[model samples]
Target: MHPINLNEPATTRPTLAESLSFTCQLGECRSELLPLLSEVSKVVSGEGSLSKTLKLVLELMQKHLQVTRAMISLYDASCDQIFIHESFGLTKDEIEKGVYYPGEGITGKVVETRQPIIVPVIADEPLFLNRTGSWDKTVDCRLSFICVPIMRGMKVMGTIGVERLYNNRQLLYLDLEVLAIIATTIAQAVELHLLERAHKQVLQAQSARLDKELKEKFKPANIIGNSKAMQSVYRMIDKVSHARTTVLILGESGVGKERVASAIHYNSSCGGGPFVKFNCASLPESVIESELFGHEKGAFTGAAARRAGRFEEADGGTIFLDEVGELSLSAQAKLLRVIQERCFERLGSNESIKVNVRILAATHCDLTAMVAKGTFREDLFYRLNVFPITIPPLRERGNDILILAEHFNAWFAKEQQADVPAISTPALNLMLNYDWPGNVRELENMMERAVLLAEEGVIHSYHLPAALQPAVLGELGEQSGLEARLSMMEYELIVEALARFQGNMSRAAAQLGLTRRMLGLRMAKYQLNYKDYRCGD
Candidate 1:
């Protein structure tokens, strides 16, 4: 008799007499076998847990088949061995000893050759190692054994074996056929379980990678400032990041208060949680309340669905309220309650919901001044003032402008897929002397524009906006004195000459019809550096 080929249907190979004989016995075992298959099917299709499904398979086999011992040994491809994964009618100690190398015994040989084996009598078959100690060699054990490979397509994943009394030999072939069918089902279930586990692992790895990237992007080191004022802000951030204190970031309109809030959230103890932000000034006064504390369905006109508020959404995380000073007095009252009690009701509902969200508020307006004018609540100001961090305006952060310029240069270069150009000394000097009223936001926009305008692989002063030109040029018309005006024009001529000649003093002086020594004296008087024009070289 040849081993059954699992790749084909189980019914294809048997002869008419063999088929009739198995069919008669199959009918006899139908009462018990039908329920066993039903239960195994439920297990395999439901949760698809491999261990639980294997355990159920073994338990049903022992109960319905009246086997002395039953075991399922799964193949470990890494070690090329079959280890007992689930077993019925065996002690824990005996199960621990049930391991076999390829072709070691009946069970191992079945797995190694992807075939089935049946021993009519265990005492007569030399290949039956009895590693599980189901039968004693000293006694006359009348046990018959059958083992079959659990095949997935052409590959054998494991083997299922059962031992029964010798008197049950009349239906041995029938039992083998049933076990083979069950083994095929087990193989498919195992394959599906493995595939699902691998897919979950891939998703988890991708999630972890995205989380790591977000954390790094918002880390304190990436905030882009080395000024003393920014150093103080960094220290404040470090001190309050792990705490649940309410942070109030004070700065000018374009000073990156939101970025500071994000840095605090992503570096805090609740970094893994969500960070929800709302611009209180951007929304209308009529709907700002509903936006912060979401309203119920049909609560107001066009309110079609129940929506979670930022506070509710940011539970166990952080919420940044930008332009907090713009909130109405009624909204301020509701916000004050959340800050003090950590609970608030929805806009149209009286049901109070509790949340554990960290508050990080930012505003360009002075809340204290607004409170004096009765536009803001005084009590709310004190509550939000627990930990105040003031970000310096760009004019006060000396030399940080150059650092930020380079950062923006590289960022926009990559964004536009262009090469980052070197900043000329004249351009750097103009940036340093300019009093940036729009702060970092304006500087970032200006750098992006400069990169777009740059054509010679270097950022010259001409690439900068006309607004960045010296205040002296704007002051010329107001200064009515002829001497002052003439001196200004002379200074301009010398600078323009030097710039036109790429800082070559001889060429500049010859072009301007002045000796090199006289041009050097004028350059000193105007505080102009000749080397700043060398980009033309």
Candidate 2:
């Protein structure tokens, strides 16, 4: 391929499409057409995107084909719809109304027949719809119109068109051949765009569907948390839901570590299969192997009947080994073999029984330290750590305590028909101050007790659990760490202080025991203004 000067008019250069046409007449175009194609070859060989390639095709056609107006409509292979993607002469309104179905118009006919259409007069062509409204009631009464089908093998994807200003016998066969070559260029560009759009749509649909299905199927009744940290864990569940990998759920005790493990398995590819749960800490060192790997008839002293092990039962699914750090030395070695080879033998059966399942292990104990102490297999740790999702505890995630408390409180109120009081300022203060060691699971328990004790809609200071409540019910406690709680509070104290002072700068500063400048910095950090709280401050 050689270069052609793009600045020259279209009639000067012979198009490659014109070379392939029977009607094209060649006089003096070979020299001009060859260099243009060479430049085209260089550009088309660079970035292989739909937009770039379409622009290239239009440039090629404009250089060689002495015709009026051109357009490329692409076929969305998946949707079976034709849409005009790019055009040079069509008005914006014309383009908006440019969608074509098979056999509907001249373009449609070419697409339907997988052949070219040569209408010397567009107005004379029977299939031409002339969309009068699209072009302000003015029909394209061109004397020479040519439409050719663009094909990917036998399937017609789109059509490219070229029309001469007037019907003339003087137009050479080489010109039509050049237009045909340009039409082929349009076809290649359409294919690339269609494929790219299809890939993006497929990925988007998969991601959305997976997220929706996970929330519906895997939500356990006992698990509770709407905090950002817990939502982060939920998003991880959505991401790894369909993946085939080892998942390690890490959290402190009473943090519903088992609940997180269940969500993972139920959302995974092995969701339809059995969920085999085993407490590694509860099983004795000698029997842990038989319990996990299963025993055949007479495999052990108490092997009264042929029993399938946890692994065998959980085949084609997930095996949740809770407290996995407590596995003894021998058990860790056997487990490592299962992780590496995915093959394990029953206690009595010498025949190797291969299990097809995802491994989900949970631990309240620190496995990192256990790996350092040589109590746990480092290889097993790495294998299961493919996706490690941690459930953050209550102490770090503030406000989640209130959200979960309100949820569980509502549940308990409905269950027992108790008239639970609204949370008092003092009780809320106590709640905000106390460090909940038990996390969301603990907050749920406290709410249950509060709902039971409260006599009214308010869960007052009296309704709070002993651990969370100050001894003096009526008064806010001095040693209750309310000062420290206010210091750590993000926005509530600043808002309340500003409200009490009626947003007067000096008064609000005096109320908060801060300089006006210090108060401003706090206001900036929280994005709060006293004017925001006031009807008219």
Candidate 3:
């Protein structure tokens, strides 16, 4: 087939009949072509989506050319195939199944060659494979197939094709010309759409990279402690993060259970996947199942639309079920199935959905105790207890209290945009002595409050909560009688003096209004390490 140059003038003057036919075709083309171009130009310049624009183009093709079916097949570079992306007069099933490899059929050949193909009759064209299943051979003898390549420079990005009823052969040529022009106009829109999509992908990749870096920087290692208990927790996190095993984080409330769960997720192989968290205790029994497993549209009174639950959303990622012990027995039964089979059905639907999510459950309550009491399922407990990590309470973490205090102090100071203050020795002692009933959460809150209250670049004992004062002093008082309390007071005074005097025993004794021998006896009685005081000085 020779290329008909749209720009080339006719070689000779037209005959009377040829001129009349050309005028009739021109009138038909102007009526349909002007509106098509106007609508397409608006779509290309405006914020209309690529699908809507393509569908409009196909609809115009059918209306103008008496087309039976029109479709656009977009090139997928990843799969090295062309698949129908948008179409007119094709069912959803047909559109979904329409796929053609490069050079597979007439459409594929057009894409491969970067040229157009015109089939005068479908029955005579061996290359027409009718892959879309929309073509009926019994009564379609008059169907003329025309496909044009949608190009971006020399590259064939996709193909636009239409099936129109055969009429005059001369009119068929004009139709081919119109289709080529329309395809060229649609190509620009497709190019812009692809570029916009590529830009979004690049931005998303950058965002994901930044998010991953932040997660890595603030992982469990940044939990502000090097205590033996914390070190053990870190070791457990390292071991559990690499596996897809179920993790049961056991700890009292406010012990940083959620922090542990986050650490496990961000350090794992599936870190690139999402980290979905749901609090079982926060949702009521009636809604807990729907929240975990999702619900179909109209499944319940308030379910307005189909929803994907935490498990479904966490597919190929990690889902942290905080306060797992609060799940109802029915919910537990469904959760056990998900843990055992990696599949579950949404509420009010029988279709099972499979997920490859890691489970990280946490609770302050003892599952073992709950199981014995019949409130929790024993089978589910055993399933979730594959690996257990118990975070130590703040009261039992020893010197981690001071470490955490200093960390929180600096953090709060920065947050408040104020100068960070030093913790006075008296303040430090008071904090170390108090039993943190609310655990790490309470300690953090106290530190934040102290930072806000501190004004003199030093967090004095008075800056802390007033309740902590009585608690620390009462604990010491209860542990000793009146004589012992007097001895402790004397010891504290001597220690302060020694620190003030740079650990010089004579100067310390002078400051304390005592002889060197009496001061030494008091220090020995209290087991005061003089070297510790000297180092501070």
User: lDDT of model 2 at residue 113?
Assistant: 73
C-alpha RMSD values across all candidates: 27.8, 25.5, 30.1
Local distance difference test, each candidate:
0.78, 0.67, 0.77
Give the TM-score of each candidate. Answer: 0.51, 0.47, 0.51
The predicted structure with the larger TM-score, 1 or 2, is: 1
- The parts of candidate 3 lying over 4 Å away from their true place are 1-219, 471-509, 512-537
- Encode model 1's per-residue lDDT on 173-212: one tens digit a residue: 6678778878977886554333333333543465466456
By descending lDDT, how would the candidates be arranged? 1, 3, 2
Error of 2 at 204 (Å): 31
Model 3, 198-259: lDDT tens digits are 43354346546645654543337546665667778888998888999899999999999999
Alpha carbon lDDT of residue 414, candidate 1? 92
Q: For candidate 1, what is the total of clashing residue pairs? A: 0
